[model samples]
Target: MNDVNVYTVTRLTRDIRLVLEDTFQAVWVEGEVSNFTVSSAGHTYFSLKDESSLLNCVMFRGNSGRVGFTVKDGMQVLCYGRVSVYDKRGQYQLYATKMEPRGKGALQLAFEQLKEKLYKEGLFDEANKKPLPFLPMHLGVITSATGAAVRDILKVARRRFTNIKISIYPVRVQGDEAKHEIARAIEELNEYNRHIAETGGEYPVDVIIVGRGGGSLEDLWPFNEEIVAREIYASEIPVVSAVGHEIDYTISDFVADLRAPTPSAAAELVIPLKHDLTVRINEYRDRLYLSIKTKTEMLEKAVKTSRDRYVLRAPMNVFLQMRQQVDDLLRTAVSGISHSLELKQRDLGTVTGKLQALSPLAVLERGYSITFKDGRIVRDAGLLEEGDILHSRLSLGRVTSRVEHVG
Candidate 1:
């Protein structure tokens, strides 16, 4: 015991770590992943197991970022790192510097994973896409300043509509920093639009075009990044993705409101030909003028026809016909009244003759007279007294005398 060396737990772990790290430094291991986990700090922890044995592995945030593809349990992967020991856990593990999927390229695997994830989150839904403006007066573009994409867009836009206003935000279209720059450009343009809308300012960007010239998948990797995809999806203004030729598609393409095959194509889609619009306006104006003229001519013809009618052309004749009808009616009324008066006169004469025949005057006129005593008619001689005064009514005169004999 005195001759042998005693090692503390820390000393043992350190010595083992140094030995393993030296023996397996910069190694490549192949295995299926299990017990995979990522910490909030972005450190990835997992176990790589072969058929017989398992090895614990750890990847810190710095190295994990370059891994390209997400690591999950049950995925077969190739890891390059050195074996090391954890002092606290007294465990030996692999500190991975790089990790890649077994059968696919790192960038491609990452693209597929992110695409599936965002698609499941509904970022690619057609309902989420905004409708592009029929005519965008102001456009916001994000691309390399000297790239062919910008030139193509400007040329096409100028040719189609000379008055369209374009505001370019130059950004790196490739490399590690491209994703951040692209995302930031989208955010700034959105903020600019919001500011203009809130303050009622002029020249608000109606649409945004994010694009680059056609290139390989690696060259276009920035647009595939989640940061750029999210910003494009959340933009207030519509985004037109013109990332590459018709054959190339990026994650940005799916999330954008519209996808154009090229930057020139994007301009063609957004801007209408000024000459065509002018022609349409002139056509509509001609149609309206023709319609009004036709209606006016029809009205004029109708008025002329009305004026040519006999009643309207000879108004005095209409009045004369009305007056003649009134005079005829008046004559008929007067003739009817005269005939009625003659008949009435004949009837009155007949009535008068009949009345005279019924009166006592007719008897007197026939030479018979009426006698009265004391104002009463003396129809009976026995009603008279010898000294009574008598009156006689003749046809011509009346006689008053004293009565002497009753018989």
Candidate 2:
């Protein structure tokens, strides 16, 4: 007998159904939901259909409660579940673990999920946002090399501030490689800036603007990616997001230090207005000129008034006053000399009178006489020898005499 044994056709079908169910159980699909129906057992059945194909799907009560919005027919959605074959009817269908409205496409949905996750982690907090320099000498731009965004930004910035310096780090703005390219460009700019600071060179850039022009949600999806957001948040330089139009918002905008409605607007915000600055300079110049003129006029008036002062206005009167002072000084000197002479004359007369009072001629004139015995004047009359000769003296002459009596 042959070793091979044949099984019933029912068993073969059952085995095949088990494999099909396992395959469907792990797959995810996105499509519009149609013919959605609920069973009495609380199970949901819906057909997922794209424009060309359709797949049967099922959601139990547990997964249905977790859905964000109501599930309805003709609604586009994403269903995540596993393929399974119903053992009773041997039909394959999707066993959904989760379902969501298809408002955002797959890429955008991934972006939003990452953005929400990072935001919760505080990477997009305003507290961590860096302030851009008011007057930046250098600006870094991260965008596609050939994109219109770069051109628009350059045009606006050049017209606003001709002295601004720009460095371009060109990268893909869309497609599979865009996210990595943008992230790398931002990191490179930061690294370059750090190196410049370390090496004592000019700062690499004062601000950085990272974005591309407006596009469909899918085309602008890279700016909304998590990697780009993290790079923008981590950058040391101030970052300005200029992705899409005013109505369109991206993750980069939320994570950036500043958000501009358009690329041209971003340029305007970052660069100063040259014409306005010129007007201010002219105004200051005029003010300084006026101040100098006013001060000069005041000084000139002071100088003219000083030149026309009282002394200068009457030259002869000033001379007359000086001459009167000189005359007064001469009169004082003459009076002092005359007074000194009179005092000296009075002192001389008194000395002369004293000399006269003590003079012998004055005694003679006063009728005083002197007598001498033996050629000597006698001061006393008590002692006299007999037969002594006496002399008499007057103020004008002397006489000789002899003494005869003793007393």
Candidate 3:
């Protein structure tokens, strides 16, 4: 019994864990995901199951943060990790380092997920979009300076509008550092514009064009990043996204104020053709000149007609005619005054008759005599005192009498 090898539970578990981890380092496992959950600490725990068996898996936050897409139950996935055992449970599980969807690429899945997310958040609403200027004085461009995109833009700009001021902010359009660089470029350009505004400097950037030449999804991943999308959304200056060919669409395109199919198209959109502007201006000038000429010709005709008339060609005849008009007006005014005076006299006669009918003298003529004292009509006889001189008014004349009794 003493010669027999002895193994404790801890020793057995530790030996198994080391063996599994060593042999299964960086093994690739493909299966349908189930029982997936993300812990509060951001670690992901899930089970990968086949038709016959199930394997437990855990992705720490460090590795899970790098995953581009959401993982859920019932979704087929491919996981790369090393097998390890938990000492507490004595169970073997996979410690995943990387994960990807089986059918779609990681970046593509990530893009779709982020688009849905931002759309739900109202970031992609048309109401939030800024309007591009009709004619921008200065333009800001963010792209690879040495790439074909810059060349295409410059070529279009030269042909379309040569006087527009353009400032280029060179940045990488791919790789790990590309997104950061692109975001920083947008921010710096905005800051520069702000500085120009505060200082009232000339040629401040009116609009920005963020773009790149056509490339694979992998190459264009930088523009698809959420950071780039947010930066484009936050930009005060209107942003025109011109990434890749017409077929390509990135997150930046969705968030930008406008999206052009290519960099050349972006240039054509922002810069109007000088020749076309000149043609329009010439049309306007011609129309204005024609209008003025018509007005002048009308005025000249009016003046010539005035000169040909008797007024300007014969001054004495015009004066004689004016004198005759004045004499006619004077006669008309005299006739009007005589007719008005006759009408007023007739009206006055009628008014006098009406006033005479309403007068107290009319009552006196009807045999009613009014008594007056001290020039006022005596309405009450009790107001008269003895020996008071009362003037009794009759229809013909006034009689002066003395008050003898209070009757």
Identify the candidate with maximal lDDT: 1
Top candidate when judged by TM-score against the true structure: 3
Per-residue C-alpha lDDT of model 2 across residues 1-407, encoded as one tens digit per residue: 38887766678668877887665557778899999988888788899998798888889987775553456788788889888767677676788988877775555556667777888999878899898887898999998889899999999887888898999999999997899999999999989988998999975789999889999987888887777888888888899999989998988899999999988889999998989989999999999999999999999999999889988899899999999999999999999999999999999999999999988778877888877665576788776777877777677787666666777
Poorest 10 consecutive residues by lDDT, candidate 2: 104-113
- lDDT of candidate 3 over 179-269, digit per residue (tens): 9999999999899888988999888789999999999998888989999999999998899999999999999999999999999999999
Per-residue lDDT tens digits for candidate 1, residues 1-407, read 99999999999999999999899999999999999998999999999999999999999999998887778889999999999899999999999999989999888999999999999999999999999887789999999999999999999887888999999999999999999999999999999988998999999999999999999999999999999999999999999999989899999999999999888888888888888988999999999999999999999999999999999989999999999999999999999999999999999999999999999999899999989887888889998888888999999999988888977
Ranking by TM-score: 3, 1, 2
Model 2: what TM-score? 0.54
TM per candidate: 0.73, 0.54, 0.81
Off by over 4 Å in 3: 50-52, 313-328, 335-407
Query: How much lDDT does each candidate structure score?
Result: 0.93, 0.85, 0.93
Tell me which of candidates 1 and 3 scores higher on TM-score. Answer: 3
C-alpha-based local distance difference test score of model 2: 0.85
How far off is residue 344 in model 3, in Å?
6.3
